[model samples]
Target chain A: MTTDRAHSLKQLRRMLLVRRFEEKCAEVYQQQKIRGFLHLYIGEEAVAVGALAALRDDDAVVTTYREHGHALVRGISPDAVMAEMYGRATGCARGRGGSMHLFGAAQRFFGGYAIVGGGLPIAVGLALAEQMQATKRLVACFFGDGATEEGEYHESLNLASLWRLPVLFLCENNFYAMGTALARHAAVPDLCAIPRAHGIVSESVDGMDVVAVERAARAAADAIRETGKPRFLELQTYRFRAHSMYDADRYRDKAEIAEWKKRDPIELFVARLKAASVATDEDVAAIEREVSGEVERAALAADAAPLEPISDLERDVLAKVVP
Target chain B: MTRTTYREGIRTALRTALHDDPRVFLMGEDVGKYGGAYACSLGLLEDFGPERVRDTPLCESTFVGAGIGAALGGMRPIVEIMTVNFSLLALDQIVNNAATLRHMSAGQFAVPLVVRMATGAGRQLAAQHSHSLENWYAHVPGIKVLASGTVQDAHDFVLEALADPDPVIVFEHQYLYAMEGELELGPARASPWRASVRRAGADLSVITYGGSLPKALAAAEALEAEGIRAEVVDLRSLRPLDDETILASVRKTHRALIVDEGWRTGSLSGELATRIMEGAFYDLDGPIARVCSAEVPIPYAKHLEDEALPRVETIVARAKELVARRG
Candidate 1:
């Protein structure tokens, strides 16, 4: 709602940060720094940043493995996230979770769960907790279009709807479940119908436009809070990078990637900001510079972080019981 | 001492947990209106109301995952997965989420969740309805596997397991639910982590748990007729096995025989045998032996089912052979 110059710039800076951070990760990944299933949120930045901006800090967030953008936008620092991927003692998860699993309980960001549709039920439970406590705090669960193919996804939707819990089922439909395209996997390629079939209030948004994403997400979140029911949003987006670092990318065409890259969320947002006279060319340049500097420092700090000793390997298998 | 059936003991535990903890809730198929598939939660719905006693649709994976989520969200959730056979549908949630959440999240999130399910083979419930797969859960690192065979354990382990800060799997043996026993009604006697010496002897250590505990005890009793004093050790908690008590029993008895209702191949009995070999091999008078179920799908026929599962006859025979060996 507060889409003034300052707030608009903040969102722009956040998107820029997510973009720059992943770009740096992609760079360092080639240098053999970050390892293991790096599913970059390179193009889907608008979905995480825009949707996260629509909710309160206390509202929970449960997202997928491809959640660097979501975690960064939801308030985890680049250093902590980077250090986690670096497997450092000072990391957000104490170096336990790598790129696929980022956790910050203090922020109420439940985690970046790796399993597809695995986080959906968790998000429903978080909302169930909030509902039982009468906290009015909603949970925004982000998953890909691939998750809708999972049974947990359908069950979660039904439970959330049946109980009328506050949850926003944000599906980043980037047209691919790793390598298989939507049509190849889903019998009904249209995702909105599935949630609508479950009697959930559903909407579709242009995920490339940050303004559109934020607007749709805000309305969805507001409705959930008021009705205490789940809402589904199908954000039509595309991933600018491979699914993971190891992906051969033989499934998608080169022309398709080029077309999607042309409508990159960060660049599109900057263009809209300039057109609306919300931010100047100089303001955009300053934001880019600031994000780049922060990313550089975070990468350096993470590289210097220490790996936990083998003695502490068994520390978290179970919580220590008090005698 | 309170004389109650194992079913009543479980019911009491559930009743007490729901009454005491405001955050605790039980959800599973037929748990509410139908009073649970096993009737362990016979009148919980009427007592606690709908919010606390939830009867879920048969979406095991989602409900189990929801339990893990609710636990992570700071609510104590107890999810019932009807039977171990049906639990396979939610294996992803149990193995991947509940068990892996704590360690993978670097302890930032502890899944203080309890999952209860009926387990083991008996009755006329054929192949699909009967099986003992606690070994699969015990194989995981972050979970505590509890097998409640007696009335006291049925009443106690559920209460104690809830106090644990990690995921605990409670397997209530289907056959043992009707067995009535005496419960020392007071505070829980001890931590559920250690094995309990049900009947002590100096000849053979007959190790077992869950439905097989009774069979092993009966076998020990029958073995006593022939002057073979066999000790019975009930492994209350299967995952964090009480190796010290097991070793101590084997050290004292100088012989060991494991009776388990599960299949012999890749069984909890095998793990126990390995642990005994590692800890008290020198003290053993002969090769460690185990009397486990026949490696076949459980049959509904009374005669076949009885022969397939570990029996007191098999246990006594295995013990006599082990004790007779001169090695």
Candidate 2:
């Protein structure tokens, strides 16, 4: 149908932008430009692009440090993100927070927290605010399969389910948590089943397929907004890059990587759009060119950005103290 | 003026906060159905219902993180760790997330959270549960630390902490929980932000707080027998320290004696001594004397535990030595 073609084309563009953005980050990381733990969201573009499409602009998003893709898909400009990665004042957090911590107040994107499972409770808390204030906004919390083992994840889920907070927990199960496979860390290989144990309604979708991810996200978001009950989505995905700049790639095999690479989300979505005649090769090339230029501009802006002076260190510690 | 016990004063503050604001709620282990481990939250469950006075599981990190999350979500959450020793389990959440969120977010988020727990020794509950670690928290950048040594502050500071937009830790002394006093039943009135001069004198300044306050006060009184005047100051707030009060007292006395419950090495006394040296180095008549607990884990035996913490006798001797010495 026409609707399917339109959706696939849109997803193709979004996924291309994310994939290109992360690839650019990897290239720059090799040049000794951006430092610290830079976790690339290269192959997991569908998880962010597809799921982000289902939610409204006002919905809050809390994600892990591998969140450049999420921040970009959530409408934070790639230039600001790249500049932030460069630790520039022009970036999202004014260069105070780098890759592991990207903030976008305008878009209601809470941040990219570095600590595994740290953002779960924060996301739940944001949903709790919406619930208590009678707001219709839903909070979409994104984390990796590694965060599932953290106690904060379980506690936040239990509290969210118990209180019936309007929250959608989107887990990007890339099958690896910082080079350690999910099978090695988690007792339950099926991450979706873990949320169900906390009485949360859950669904596991093929994260490599943008259409499936979008479909599940749409249903989950609608249910949460309507009933004020939490829903969980486990998107089965993979990471093409190492966990960080320091990874030796010893944890996983090349055959496994090749198998997942064969089903690359960006290429598959572009192919689907082409098959339906909704997008030509030229259109795909144009989107990629646009995304590449934007990423480049962001990096340029960041490189020129100034670092914060040491004198203002004591500022913003407390909002207001009633002395 | 209405008279009340230390426990009653804390209860009154919690009751007033809950009654005044719908967003303020208390969450901790044994704080609800069990009526709190210290009985400071006694009858609150019956008054405010189980929703506001939540009883959390023994999972300190998870619940503390939940409290931080709840605070982030617009609720003023009061997380109570039963003791200072148990709070170590939740240190990751307290130090990493709760303390750093505001700075990391560039002032976008305000953690209006209050974490209250019992601290210090003398109850024979030694080693694991009897240590005082407020100094460790005070050393952190973002958090405000308060040690309630008196009945009035134990009752009033909780209200002040809830009103503060940053995270605050209120350490209630375990030994002083039962010490009763007449409390004025009017609006809460105590400076939660500054130290108070409990017993003003001229010769030497006895700087202390929490479990060591009573000992310092007693030592000051005992020093009066030797014709020496020792000013006693209750360091109510430790973090945004009442630097002016301490400096003024030290400037006037020209001598300082620090009484602390924590051990000697890298103690809060060392920090205060550095501050005094930096602020009023020329005013000192002699090197600062520090009366701190022996550098050993508090033993379970009553006598050994008593000997482990800073005692009135040790404080008196330290004061005498400082007064007798010439710079």
Candidate 3:
């Protein structure tokens, strides 16, 4: 509906929204309102914003614990997700899932699969169903590079290829897979090898560049749409923060963190947009203000949200009894 | 009147479900061209075509997890994991994903997944292939456990599982596949949700399920010859256990003898004994007793395997001993 410039601006705003929302989340987490493992998706915004921009809203998404940005970009209201993190009754998951287990069934945002590589098989299932139904929708399954250590990583890749299911396997290579670097964990740090080994068409993209990410995702999505097959993308990006709130920065070198920060996804995207005459400094400032307002309002609403009643403690164990 | 083997009972259910529902499909190792590992899904692939009656590449976890995923995505997926031993590989998917999805999503999503597997020991499959892990699945919340003990149940329970909105784990005892019985439909048969009294007696209640049902019934018959009439209760639905039927039978008989193929230590029989004790502590004529498999891996030798499992002789002897003892 919008021109390329307008679309580019929307993607930039989404990145800013993800950035600011998580920033507020980090702030809320300090107050202990958002308990549990708060995995802020502050740095790796482009990967979600750019990649999701290229896909249709009907397509399914199954991602890992670091999924706040994905959930936001995929149309889960920040207020609802924030309320979930706050353990509110009106949260998207009715306050049960917390931050790490956000679920949006209606949105086809299947989960916040906390287990490493656990989402892969679920993603394959979604794709399998879509393929069976002859739907053009593809599943964008996101996982960390550390997930390669799992047997399911190989199993899912093999199954997706064997069935030629419509799944865009997005491996957000954020360098560190929770304290252990991808190099330290994987024998062949080349993230694309396993998919290629499974005969999947694989490519790598600079996850820091929003336009580049959107372009690569569009191409891959198009290929899957036409071929009704699986594709893989190693979104080579970096998380500016620690894995979770509890993670001490003992694993990474300070210099390495700063080095990756030089290619900060948001900063790089802002510079790209400005250079291409898509936006001005004032426009960027306006988006920053708008994002800040949205995040602040979401945080306030989440703070005011009521905790779930104790009487409903054991709800949803089963949807309905067989009797 | 119709007759069917336990295997055919399951095949009929599969055929009926696939014929009726467009979203229903079956997938497992050798379910398609191989006609299932035990022939439970024989001729289904040919009837429904390969897309619906799918065969996997021996990757138990992915296929099971895929079923969980597909179930979440509006498809009724019945995933077969060859045996309970192989089902262990897919435990993460079953326990972590399927069981936790509804609770974790806080009632927003329901995983209408049906996972079927062959369980128990009899044909000398040895330790790796022979295990009764129904207690493991039944122990979890958000999942329904069904182990059909009769031909009607074996055929009908699959349809029941498909109708339910939550994940159901059906354990078709590999030993009972060839056992044949006449199908009894209509109001006489109870729903899959309740326990059925296979035989009614005024003396003591013999509670069992799956592979142990026939042995318990045979034991009850032998007791009848000795003038000690023992009631036989088949627990079709293991989870959300039909406590009313079991307790009523136990109260009427004033005695209960539990039989199960799982080991005595931390067994479903143990749970049943505790529940019976809790529910009917005062209405007992004798101390509650259980005849469980000996605490050892089922050996390949027929004699050793027979000794390890709950035989009719073991159940009869245990019931007689319990009947003789006074509370």
Candidate 4:
């Protein structure tokens, strides 16, 4: 296969993996295995798979609680991610940070900040560090449309722009801040305008399409690299699952949900691959099997992983005193 | 040895830290150009240049949170929050991010950030600008909270706090900024974790910190004139309360009077009183008494403000009463 074909195939495989992993998480949550505020990125897989594909290895990523997809794509081992959900010793955060706090320092994945708009300032700071160090590295900060209403969002944008820090503000506009629609929470639902008001370059993209997200992210990342300034991209997408396991999801209409499902990212991407002759039917079937197998193995490994010792409960609260 | 004002001591400490460590930088609103709201970072901006001394926008949360991020990225950052009242704007970043990041990240990162903010009421800065809220910060777990009561502590604790690999909050009492004292500053004379007995006595223990330290000492002196010797214990570190020093003092005096500027309701004084009750109940000759600010919002009127806050007269009176009640 050609290089482009291989890359497209890889994207398809990643999206499938995220979808299948989240499906397994949902299943196990009911089985009493994975617990505590599981936010599945079922419909928003394309944004993570696409945007992360544009980042360099040394570049940093700070994301929100709905960050399993971001973590997986940022090269964190799926087994470690799964183990973290199980609260095991081998987890990314050593079982201390459950679903909403996954961290992989080696990969420069800062955290899965549960607080809305909390990660924005941290991203600006990370970018400031790189700028001060005269490094070309940039930081990608991911938050929801709901975060636009937060003061940190505005503050972060202003600081990033004023300092000319290299940062990509990826606003994943899933249209709901946990059942409160954007219109109800924000004066202006067009999040792209919010960053523009802060004097940062801003744009909105079809977040459901992986190729579009990748293109927009690469352009934004490149612009930040060239100018050492911040850029904002509003990824317009939807969430297929309930906000968390506990949500009754009574806030939205079923008709709206069904309409969004018609443009399901994974299904649309598979059709695009086939139409473009990037992958045949047999190839697609093979990719599905591989992704399913990987998810199964990860689940099994997480289940077998050891629990952190109770005696070490106080570990990592403070940095260990170097003797 | 040089005599320095509390403000000068803080400025000297910042200068020393900047000169000592290449990784250290100062960022805050008006820190660089305006020379700091409390003038603690004056002249250093011109000395170090703009890159090391950054002047940020008037957005507290983002700037404070940025300090945390910069620390995580391997730079020692000293973020000034103007005053405790303004620090509230950044409380989310301080309490949620800086304090919790190390633990939440499971040791993947340590925020070596020092946040300096002027605290307490005395200049009649009104309800918005004045209030003692160090207790709120001390209530946190991950971050270390230090109250600089003297010129020596103001000069030294900044260095010690910067050396630590955790987030540390240094509360500079706004009232004590102009107070001058001789400091033999080279290395810090004491750890920021332990409490120091400012004055030693056997009759009563006057426990206090920050802006109340002088009042506590004055009360001790007044008691000395009255033939009642009172020990003055300055609680330099608020978070890890030096239970040893406190218990030792209580054991010696058999009477304790906590003088705190923070209000009586859910104050650090209350916590200290509880600690004394729990550990040295048998050692106590009388019930533990406390002179804290009134529960009402700190009024702007000087007399009302004086009444609201713990005064030297109140401290002396409370001490005398406690001593008399010691049976």
Model 1 alpha-carbon drift over 4 Å, by segment: A1-3, A321-323
Q: Which ten residues in a row have the lowest lDDT in candidate 1 chain B?
A: B183-192
Q: Model 2: runs farther than 4 Å from truth? A: A1-7, A321-323, B185-190
**Isolated chain A TM-score, each model:** 0.98, 0.95, 0.98, 0.98
Error of 4 at B13 (Å): 0.8
Cα-based lDDT at residue A316, candidate 3: 86
lDDT of 4 by residue, A55-144 (tens): 999999999999999999898888999999999998999898889999999999999898898999999988888888889999999999
Collision pairs in model 3: none
Instruction: Locate the minimum summed-lDDT window of 10 residues in model 3 chain A.
Output: A1-10
Q: Against the true structure, whose DockQ is highest?
A: 3
For candidate 1, the clash count comes to 0
lDDT of 2 by residue, B133-175 (tens): 8889999988999998888888778888988889999999999
Estimate TM-scores for all models: 0.99, 0.94, 0.98, 0.98
Candidate 4 ranges with C-alpha deviation above 4 Å = A1-3, A320-323
Model 4 clash pairs are none
- Residue-by-residue lDDT tens digits, candidate 2, A199-310: 9999999999888898899999999988999999999999998888888889899999999999998888777777778888998888888878887877777777787677
Candidate 1: tens digits of C-alpha lDDT, residues A212-322? 999999999999988888999999999998899999899999999999999999899888878877888999999999999999999999999888998998888888542
lDDT by residue (tens digit), candidate 3, A195-246: 9999999999998888788889999999999999999999989888888999
